[model samples]
Target: MTGPTTIGAAPYDALLLFSFGGPDEHDDVMPFLRNVTAGKGIPDSRLAQVAEHYEHVGGRSPINGQNLALMAALRAELSRRGVELPIIWGNRNWAPYTRDALIELRDRGATRVLALVTSAYSSYSGCRQYREDLALTAGSLEEELGHDLGLRFDKVRSYFNHPGFVAGNTDAVVEAYEQLRARGADLANAPLVFVTHSIPDTMEDASGAARPSYRTQHLDIAAVVAEQAGQRLGVDLTWSLAFCSRSGPPSQPWLEPDVNDGLRELAAGGTTAVVLAPIGFVSDHMEVVYDLDTEAMETARELGLTAVRAGTVGTRPVFVEGLIDLVLERAAVERGESPARAVVGRLGPVADACLPGCCRQRAGVDSGVPALCGQD
Candidate 1:
């Protein structure tokens, strides 16, 4: 083959798209919430308040649609390259469980598979938990079938530093700036705020120095987008990282400043215009729809400030191409061939095989679960 994947998943027979599942309808709401907060002992009454957010939006999460779009885009890209690859999908929390997807792959006669998770950054909830879930699911499926399916799974490296992700975020910010300027919003003093889902601060500290922490990952990408957008706009862009979707016990601390809080401060600081870029997500999921589009937008209106919400890199051509590049690079690596690892901004490239201690639940403490898909 002239290029990687031209023959289609050379070392890997299939590909799995892993993601955080969400409810599909009104009836699925409470069950989905229970699935998401199983061990946390959150009462239905408390969860109902959160459920209202879903109920407000017709009781469905856009994540499933987002994943489907990505899969379609991936198929189109692979087809354009004249490669045929089977893309199966699974989730940890909801329907189309990981076990079912693995069984489908096994039945497809796939002996080796490469997985790509929805999260671009590495964290316990994002990375290690996914590895743990996949291993557990495949093992259970093997037991159910009473034999080794001869199936093995590998995953592509994290794409936080990939040029495709950087460029997508940069373009989003530039476009948001352009939209606001068209609406007569003052650009001379507006701030661009980059937003992401907030994890517990402890989790942030636990993401470790060897690999970029979750917070560090957002900051790195935000800085690059800020600089690039500034070049496009011919002015220095003032930007800062903010968080959305904080849902935890009030007793425990999470990341700050919250997007609403930050917006208030920005209003007080005489910033009459702003742009919010959700760099932490691959798609415009629930948090992005609710936190920014609903709550934050209202706050902005009340404060009499002009605001624009930027788009996520969902199914963007470059992002899809970048994912294809990573898939091919990992395939080449599996075949024992050296391939160029693409990266941008501050970090070089994350390892294809995770370190034993990568993305612990708590700083210096493992989750006490055996995670698979790591060299360790």
Candidate 2:
């Protein structure tokens, strides 16, 4: 191990790939769901239904594989850039939990660390919930090793509008659109549908800086990608923002115009085809596979409309390179070096840390302000 260098202000010794983990086998499904919905009062019956989504795919989720690929790519990029930082991974809802990652970091002599969450948007589940988990871990270190092993963690800024993210989405939309066109689907006039996970309206309303930050971020990313895609395709494309994989009681309102419903609306409006770009997710998780690939495809078949789902930014070269750029920019800021940050959408890069009241939970937890990376 090398001593801390003064090149960056926040001298992080290691980087952690923080994510929402998924089960890898048939037996791990219920336990994983239980971990995910622990305090949400979701019953096993409902989870059993959700489990079918995983069961359909042989009781495996592609998330873990994608995350592993990202970690490996990040390590390679860091090494190529001469940044000798090591990368580890932790999950919120599966094995190799954040606590375990913390223990590993402590045991390996990592004092200060940086985290890059899998999600790139600002929402309760995407942002605040992770902070709450980190705060919980800070107080329970003794349980991990029979004594407190102090460690520091900071998170990278949400990169929803990062140029690389936009470029990745834009490239995917273009590719999907061309494929649809080759399949005799209308490309020039087909509406582009940008999809993301559905959260309660209340959560969206509380996402960031006193506005509906979550929805706003999604919309911003959608517009940027749409513009870029249109430019690349040589035709101005119209678009709509939609939600998917909504859970909880029907009485509770989540984000509106489910992707299936959106497809029907387009079909009714005389649109012959659509490019369903899942800009909301960074990887092709179960939500994308089941909700979009299986469910939405069935819906499209019923409506007699052509629908193709664009890929996520999973280990895409441009996206990985962009992440490296983000890391270096943040490191520069920490090192008291002035560097330009890149963003493609209106909201800009999300702050390195959320504001004090950012993304507060629906029934606000009294965890206070977490001593997270940007908070300090």
User: Which candidate tops TM-score?
Assistant: 1
Looking at candidate 2, the ten consecutive residues that score lowest on lDDT are 1-10
Q: Highest lDDT: which candidate?
A: 1
Residue pairs whose backbone atoms clash in candidate 1: none
TM-score between model 2 and native: 0.94
Off by over 4 Å in 1: 1-8
lDDT at residue 264 of model 1 (Cα atoms): 96
Error of 2 at 22 (Å): 0.4
Candidate 1 lDDT tens digits, 1-376: 3443435468787889999999999889899999899999899999999999996678899999899999999988887776778899999888887878888888899988899999999888889889999887877877888998788888889898899888888888889999999999777688999999899988888886458789988888888889989998987889999999998899999989999999999999989999999998899999999999999999999999899999999998989998988998898898889998999888779999998688877877755676678864
TM-score of every model? 0.97, 0.94
lDDT of 1 at 151: 84
Cα shift from native, residue 48, model 2 (Å)? 0.9
